[model samples]
Target chain A: GAGVSQSPSNKVTEKGKDVELRCDPISGHTALYWYRQSLGQGLEFLIYFQGNSAPDKSGLPSDRFSAERTGGSVSTLTIQRTQQEDSAVYLCASSNAGGSTQQYFGPGTRLTVT
Target chain B: EDKVVQSPLSLVVHEGDTVTLNCSYEVTNFRSLLWYKQEKKAPTFLFMLTSSGIEKKSGRLSSILDKKELFSILNITATQTGDSAIYLCAVLFSNTGKLIFGQGTTLQVKP
Candidate 1:
């Protein structure tokens, strides 16, 4: 596609339930990133994948949050045992070379854990 | 501690008015500073500044970064109602390839 794309624009799940947010980065983009936007907090980085290098999961808030990039094209963010504090917008961005370049963002998925 | 900080958390301006948003960060490994305009869903890329003193402009929007000062400013001239949105600032850390973002500045351009 022309730009990054995400699925399930809106999600409402009960506490302790699991949810998966998907992201399809732009073609040939080598760097993909996941971030979350909350009411007061800024866009907090969650994880990133660059080429075949080990993903930088240092930003992940907890062990329940995990992300995987398949074939270096598409990515999925899985949140297990969702909590109400987890309600926020999950955004995905892709850059051409790495984080140094401009990133294209996808319409985020608004996840509401009730 | 927030590595990135933005000023004037929210602002209201009338059409044709110009506004300047501020962002400052404390990162030694900063690779670049980026600006984004976000509406209801996602953010749209605006500009990326890598060097100091050079300004990047797009239409009525312009941004300049000062690496030595560890700060940046985004200027929006001749603002329109359509320009109402949240403006975000982020600094990319080269070492970890992680971006530290600031609490956005919400601008409301009224007609």
Candidate 2:
């Protein structure tokens, strides 16, 4: 892909139901990240992956929120037993490397937990 | 806790008016500061400042970081209606890809 891509541009789910958002990062990129943007708010760091393992899961928000990347290409963010507060836009980004490099972002998945 | 704060949560301006957006941060480790412009969906990258006093310019948009003051400012000259968007500021960790973002400034450029 020319840039990062995310799935299900818009998603609406009932409270307590689980949801999965997907991201396909640019090829050969070694770093992938997930962020949550609430209404009128900035991007909130959720998780980061280097290769297939996530070194920094410090921002996962809660145990119910988990993300994994396989083949260093595609990643999935799963929200278990979603709450109304989980409604937000989930953004995914990929960089050639981590840190100092600029990250390319996806269109983002708008998750609405009713 | 790392924190990034942006001022003037919202702004209204006319075309051709120059605007300056402010960002200040409190972080344990500061590698670089980045600016992003978001219109509808995703945020597009603008500028990344690592050295203090050096300005990164792209057309009418320029940004400079001040490590001493722990702040950065983005200036848009002769703004256009297309410039109406949410301007975001983020601080990057030196060794990781994690970015701590500010609340963002919503700029409305009136025609």
Candidate 3:
């Protein structure tokens, strides 16, 4: 793809429901990132994937938040027992190199937990 | 913890007016600073400044980095309505490949 791509542009789920968001990064990009943005708030880093190394999950908010990158290309973010506060736009970005590389973002997935 | 701060949370300007957005950061092992323009959805890249005292420009948009001051400024000359968007600033940490972003400055240009 020419740029990063995300699935389910919008999702509305009830409380306690689980939701999965997918991301497809640009070809040959080795680094990928996931971020969450609440209404009127800045982006919050969630996770980062670099090659086959263990993902940097330091930013994951809680145990209910988990993500996985397959083949180092496509990634999935899963939220278990979603809460109303979990409603936000989930953004995915990818970069060609590791450090100081420019990131290209995908049209985020807007999740609304009712 | 790395932190990035942007001033003037929101601004409203008329077309052809010039505007400057500010960003400051405190990060360990700072490597680069990036600016992005975000509309309703995805954020589009604008400029990336690595070296101090150097300026990056594209069309009516220009940005300069001052490593000594730990800050950067984005300037838009003769702005247009299309230029209205949230301007975001981010700093990349060396080796860690982590990018910490500041709360964006929202610009609204009226025609």
- All candidates in order of lDDT, best leading: 2, 3, 1
What is the Cα-based TM-score of model 3?
0.98
Q: How big is the positional error of residue B76 in model 3, measured in Å on the Cα after superposition?
A: 0.2
Lowest summed lDDT across 10 adjacent residues in model 1 chain B is found at B91-100
Per-residue lDDT of model 3, residues B69-102, tens digit only: 9999999999999998999999987876677899
TM-scores, all models, native as reference: 0.96, 0.98, 0.98
Q: lDDT (CA) for every model shown? A: 0.92, 0.94, 0.93
Candidate 2 CAPRI level: high
Model 1 vs truth, CA RMSD: 1.2
Question: What shift in Å separates residue A62 of candidate 1 from its native position after superposition?
Answer: 0.6
Runs of candidate 1 exceeding 4 Å displacement: none
What is the C-alpha local distance difference test score of candidate 3?
0.93
| Candidate number with the higher DockQ (1 or 2) | 2
Superposed by TM-score, candidate 3 places the C-alpha of residue A99 at a distance from the truth, in angstroms, of 1.8
Give a tens-digit lDDT track for model 1, residues A1-114.
589999999999999999999999999999999999987667999999999999999889999999999998999999999999999999999988886688888999999998
